[model samples]
Structures are given as C-alpha cells and as structure tokens.
Target: MELEAAAALGKYLGAGIACLALAGAGIGVGNVAASFLNGALRNPAAAKEQTATLFIGLAFAEALGIFGLVVAMLLLFAV
Candidate 1:
C-alpha cells in the first residue's frame, strides 16, 4: 500500500513538472510577437511580407504548449 502511494505521488510530481513546458511556450510566443511587432513598426512596407512567418512562429509555439498538455495528461492517466 505504501508503494502504491509513492507511485501516485511520483506521477503527480512528474505531471506538474511537465506542465512547465506550457510556461516556456507562453514566453516563446510572447517573444515572437514582440520581435515581429518591433520589426513591423520599423519597416511598415516589409511587414506584409513577414506576416506569414509571424503566424508560423505563433503556431509552433502553440503546438509546444499543446504537446506539454498531452504529456501531462498521459503521465497522470496512462503511466
């Protein structure tokens, strides 16, 4: 019984650590947006050309957050 309790505790702790990736993803998204905005403000004409890249960066950042969520879920329920 004590071993089962220890396993459960470990799983919860691991899940919590995995969730930190979400925080990193948030910071990454913010940095990408800030950099794009800074560049666009300086060069209004070029902003149109780089819009696609900006969106790609945002998508990647969001994907990372989603991946983190999945890992946490799996750790909590599957492992």
Candidate 2:
C-alpha cells in the first residue's frame, strides 16, 4: 500500500512538472511576437513578407504547449 501511494505521488509530481512546458511555450510565443514587432517597426515594408513566418512560429509554440498538456494528462490519468 505504501508503494502504491508513492507511485501515485510520483505520477502527480511528474504531471505537475510536465505542465511547466506550457509556461516555456508562453514565453516562446511572447519572444516571437516581440521579435517580429521589433523587426516590423524597423522595416514596415518587409513586415508583410514575414507575417507568414510569424504565424508559423506561433503555431509551433502553441503546438508545444498542447503537447505538454497531453503529456501531463497522460501522466495523471493513463499512467
């Protein structure tokens, strides 16, 4: 029984740790946006060309957050 409890605790802790990736993703998205804005302000004409790249960066960052959430859920519920 004690071993089972310990395993449960570990699972919960791991899930919590996995959720930190979401925070990293948020930071990444912010950096991407800030960098794009900086570039845009410096060169307005080129901003239109780089818009697609900005969206791609955002999508990748958000995808990482989603992946982290899935890992956390799987750790918590699926073992």
Candidate 3:
C-alpha cells in the first residue's frame, strides 16, 4: 500500500522474473546435449572425438545460466 512497500515488492518480483533466464539456459543446455547424443549415437567412433566439443557447449550454456543467477541475486540483494 505504501510507496516503500510497493518498491520492495517490485524488487522481489523483478528478481523472480530475472530467474526466468535460468529456465531458458536450462532448455538450451538440454538441447545441446540432446543433439550431441543423437549424433554420437549415430556415429560411435566420432562420438569420442566430439566429447570435448560437447563439454565445451555444455559449459557455455551453463555459464549463461550462472550469469542469469548472478543477475537475479544482485537484483534481490544489491539493487
């Protein structure tokens, strides 16, 4: 009802919304792994060769999620 209360509510809501980025990151990581496995299944020999690529993709995707989480935490605690 008060202005400060409204602002605080907004901050919490914004932080919650920012967490949605993690969901997108999760989906992206899942897609990357799924595609890699699909290709690996079809080519067993090359699967070994592509393991590094798969992990790199996974790390990149996860990094985005971690960044999103940091943003959410900053919103909740910093601003």
Candidate 4:
C-alpha cells in the first residue's frame, strides 16, 4: 500500500527475475557436456584433445551463471 513497501517488492521481484538468467547457463553447460560426450564416444582418441575445450565451455557457462547471481544480488542489495 505504501510507496516504500511497493518499491521494496519491486526490487525483490526484479532480483528474482534476474536470477532466471542462470537457467540459460545451466542449459548451456548441459548442452556442452552432452555434445562432448557424444563426440568422445564416437572418437575415443579425440576425446583427450577436446577435454580442454570442454572445460572451457563449462567455465564460460558457469561464469554466466555467476554473473546472473551477481546481478540479482546487486538488484536486491544495491539497486
């Protein structure tokens, strides 16, 4: 009812919405891993060579998730 309460509610809602970005990151990570496994199964020898690529993909995906979390935190606490 009051302005302050409504603003706080909006901030919380915004933070929650921002956190949804993590879902994309989760899907990206899963896709990368699944694709790597699929390829590795077909060519076992090449799996070792692709291992670094897989890790890089995982790290990038995880970083996106972390960025989303940070944005959510900033919305809730700072903005």
Best by lDDT: 2
Clash count of each predicted structure = 0, 0, 0, 0
Estimate the TM-score of every prediction.
0.81, 0.80, 0.85, 0.84
Q: Candidate 1 lDDT, tens digit per residue, 1-79?
A: 6999999998899899999999999999999999999999999999999999999999999899999999999989998
Kindly indicate the candidate among 1 and 2 with the higher lDDT.
Answer: 2
Query: Cα deviation of 14 in candidate 4 (Å)?
Result: 0.8
lDDT of 4: 0.94
| Span of 10 residues, lowest total lDDT, candidate 2 | 1-10
Off by over 4 Å in 4: 1-3
Of the pair 2 and 3, which is ahead by TM-score?
A: 3
> Which residue pairs clash in candidate 4?
none
lDDT of each: 0.95, 0.96, 0.91, 0.94
Q: Write the per-residue lDDT of candidate 2 for residues 1-79, one digit (tens) a residue.
A: 6999999999999999999999999999999999999999999999999999999999999899999999999999997
In TM-score terms, candidate 3 sits at 0.85
Span of ten consecutive residues with least summed lDDT in model 1? 1-10
lDDT of 3 at 78: 88
